[model samples]
Target chain A: MSHDHDHDDHHHHHDNHFSPMEARVRALETILTQKGLIDPKAIDAIVETYETKIGPRNGARVVAKAWAEPDFADWLKHDATAAIASLGYTGRQGEHMRAVFNDAETHNLVVCTLCSCYPWSVLGLPPVWYKAPAYRSRAVIDPRGVLAEFGVTLPEGRKIRVWDSTAELRYLVVPERPAGTDGLDQEALADLVTRDAMIGTGLALEPEAEA
Target chain B: MSRCETLADSPGLPVSAEGEPVFAEPWQAQAFAMTVRLHEQGVFTWAQWAEVLSREVHRPGRAVDGADYFDCWVTALSSLLSERGVASEAEQSALSDRWARAAEATPHGMPILLDNAG
Candidate 1:
């Protein structure tokens, strides 16, 4: 989080202190800067891209919109890329998108076995576990076991569909809207959409979760 | 995008199967972004970066059998920096040791503070 000439940036990260990983990165950044090999502003800009432009919140907005509008839900089911782009979530790693809905009869899981291909525009960066070898391999070979490990136990009658994303396509799971959300607005509904839910590993927050 | 260029260049590096760029850990993402940005900024060509990474992978004393591509990337970057005189081996390891000591001495779940001045 180094900003070469920005004292404000320093003050901001110094709130308590930086994390161990952040400290390590900072050490490298400080040295690279001294050698004129890197510009702190450039690093800041990259960080900003994910922090602001890309995040799970974008996908939540799409999910919320879909939930509030049945027609948009149909649109998401049919042409997710166009529908998502309509919300300005178009960019690298999200050019081609698909929305898979989770239901009582069926559950969907996403994985990229060859490599870690994710919807960066919508989900930001993939989590460490998502990219770990164990998750990547298990998500395909033993999907039910994987979901079980995540504490997601589908119904005995339910079938699980594992989507192995290639380099050109990405998938997002639209978790079923929980009960009692009937009166919630789109923003509030979006608030219930957890990043894990979109990744097909966790459920959305219950309507009363905020309370 | 050319960002895919570097990812594709490395033999064992993760290539986009059908998903966007992913960094498993924060450091991985940082390293991934740094590699791409540096390439974009003309610090190194994708080919050069890719070559250095392959060399680092096969380099002795490093975990060659491990699947940590970013570790290879970090070593490669350090080597390139030292070779180019941007920084030396002594300086790099010195800083890393300081961070390691700070991390080990810090209480569990506490923020690590390097005792550099102390």
Candidate 2:
């Protein structure tokens, strides 16, 4: 099949300007497409999937469900991959999973010191800070300080644990269930769970805050 | 807030505003999708991708602030493709040169097509 014009619309409207990297990526894509090794449509679909369909909302639902159901929480704690998959949130970057629960005395934070190995199927693409070198190195060197940068400050006595994610394993920080959220249902609770909450950079919104 | 503002607000740690685009640039997302798509198509295993990507990221003299993250991604992808015999480095470089020429030839507001090289 002729590869010409296959990715015509994929080009950004940049007044015919292309950065060196952009040109390189385009060239690589063109070569790959011409060789029939990859389909431009497949690339578009993948990008679209991550951009719209897959995101933190899925993780929020998982966290909300865990907070609502004790059994589910147990499952998430034990076997996160299966537990998260059962919720229909399973894909690349999240093949192996571990759910680190945040409690009154212990708070869990996640960072990939090597690279950004975030739980994409659940928490969506990692936030910029999650991939920033400063955050990656500092999250391990000074966990509390990193949290403070995100405006999160745990009580002095509370223990902070930083989980380093790798390609083989990814962690999801299930932020502590906010108070007065008992009356709220899973859907409402999910709303309280922000993207950063699951990444341990922020907390779940309190019932009052959400209201 | 705009990306510029976000960068300025947190120079060291650029925190994206709520509802900000997942990728800072379209090309970044495109590079990311291409890698994932290639893996899904069985061109390379996830482990292989991770190995190459990790090596690229950890290479000495690389930007410590992660600004060259996607550059690493492109380099890793090219090496992987070369290793897998999908595309040789020479072939990729030649095609990249063609793309550079095509991009220069294409008029403003028009898509840069490979055919433009000719």
Candidate 3:
């Protein structure tokens, strides 16, 4: 798309308070408007689509598919992009994914220390901590340490793996789906895949259901 | 972290690599810092990054907006790893092929582009 609008980049200079990307977003929006490539109606549609339908819905599908088929689950773990596409629900970051499965033997978490490199196609935008430097620098070195701070305790003698998502390829931590989901169909299982579960911050759906 | 430091505290002001004080503009410094950070994290080597960056530079009418900034960044990272033997040629080719297939099916034209470039 061509950005042809006469944007006031000077507006950002008055306070010098906008992040470069933030500034660029604003400038691009103006340009899009001028070029008639986008309008207020399109912006609303875009935001509404992302906020209501895309991110969370794709996440649920991934969780459900994993719970239903073991072979599919293995494929997801090794090659998340193709695995997700197999279900016809691949999103943006899921285009290049490496799904890390968390279990009693190992736990996986994600962080974008440098920037918020999240797989928005499946999980949407990142939460605050994913972009925080504290989480990023610390997650790689001491995953167990970070999990403890998050109030999650790893089983004794279990190893913790932290995957750092990048601008090109991103990761998703597939927390073990709760056991009670055994008979649930793909639709029902998808409900269990919360945003937190996809981010590796929270476990799969189940508070009281025991393993 | 320094980039985050600059983002949170100073917003528009850029910080030096040593975390020293300076007044580099946000986009310029962030673009520069992200390049540096990727290097520090072993995402890619400087030489390989420079090669892909030159391609964007040769393309006309790209400097005005930030559209190409992150796009170039990610492409450089992908290329750098392939060039340096960090990612095997097979792995690189597989990833590229997968990305192409996914892009075709993408209703919105490659969601990854929106994630990184948006």
Candidate 4:
């Protein structure tokens, strides 16, 4: 398969050669940089921000706070944008926000049916599957099936609500806190929250699972 | 099932060992960063970027698995650059051709300098 071949080549060569797409990207960057349209440093900074600094860890902290504090939970439900921004997480693709809390009878899943509109400030970039047409189309139609593929099987009586993110607004799913974690602090709680959990594709790790 | 197996089952959805989504190639990330950086620079609004991206993503005969996502992104960015008069299509293509030649001339394991094209 092409994917396998590419993977093998990547392992052996280690950036010795550029693929057609890679070359195109490089060319575009060089041209834009020369024209003063974009700074190479700024490009590196943006990529570095997404790759190393911003990620689900930010969302996990938010989720942890909500689990430990009821007032924050209420604020998140009412005005997610301000609540999230208050925590110093506010920027593009996250200007408008809504925190969908999974409860005993209801589960929330976020998807961008039109395109990959994700809460970047809080949760970082969307996952590969999150942007795939299969997930985008089937998420709203057959959420349970998609969840099952991700190894989550909700109770038959539970209702699944899929939120379709748009350019104007985005969603952050507050997964249900795993049981028997009353003693844990916010920082400890954050460790249990995974990226998929916030997207409602998986559950937060059990307290024991973390150990 | 293993993560690799799961990913193989679901085409085009690769993940890192930590289970986080990763860019398959550095170019994809570069293309993505360019769009965001340009938007931040007011070259285009996020709404405009979204509109063009959505159109490119939904275009007929595109890959459904999103393997061509960055390709569409580059195309959408190019279209916006032309529409917004930031750069003409001809200018961008000429530069692209020059970069291609530069890359061809550059020695292995060295940077592909634009100066090499001349």
Candidate 3 per-residue C-alpha lDDT over B1-97 given as tens digits, one digit per residue, 9 for 90 to 100:
3334323432122223544433112223233444444454555545556667666545577655443455444444445545665555465444444
Candidate 2 lDDT, tens digit per residue, B29-114?
Answer: 77877876677678876667777877888899989888787788888889999999988999988888887778667654244578
Off by over 4 Å in 3: A1-23, A26-55, A91-95, A114-116, A207-211, B1-118
lDDT tens digits by residue: candidate 4, A1-211? 9999988866652222344565667777876787787898777665554464234778999999999999999999999999999999886423488899999999998876423245656776565456556887788778999999998999889999988765567788999999999999999999999888998888899999999
True contacts kept of 1: 0.16
Cα lDDT, model 4, residue B61: 92
Tens-place lDDT per residue, model 3, A56-143, is 5666688778878899898897778888877675553223777888888987787764333456567754443454567767777777
Candidate 2 residue lDDT tens string, A1-211: 3455656644533234456777778878888899887788777765564454334788999999999999999999999999999988886433599999999899998876323355666776555445556887788789999899889989889998988775467889999998888898999999999988888889999888877
Candidate number with the higher lDDT (1 or 4) = 4
DockQ of 3: 0.02
Ranking by DockQ: 2, 4, 1, 3
TM-score of chain B of 3: 0.38
Could you give the TM-score of chain B for each candidate, in order? 0.75, 0.79, 0.38, 0.79
Candidate 4 chain B weakest ten by summed lDDT: B1-10
Q: Please report, as a residue range, the 10-residue window in candidate 2 chain A with the lowest summed lDDT.
A: A9-18
- For model 1, residues B22-68, the per-residue Cα lDDT tens digits are 44445556766666676787777777777888897877776555555
Residue pairs in candidate 3 whose N, alpha carbon or C atoms collide under 3 angstroms = A92-A121
- DockQ scores for all predicted structures: 0.08, 0.17, 0.02, 0.13
Clashing pairs in 1: A117-B19, A118-B20, A166-B17, A166-B18, A167-B17, A167-B18, A168-B18
Docking class of 1: incorrect
How high is each candidate's TM-score? 0.53, 0.53, 0.48, 0.53
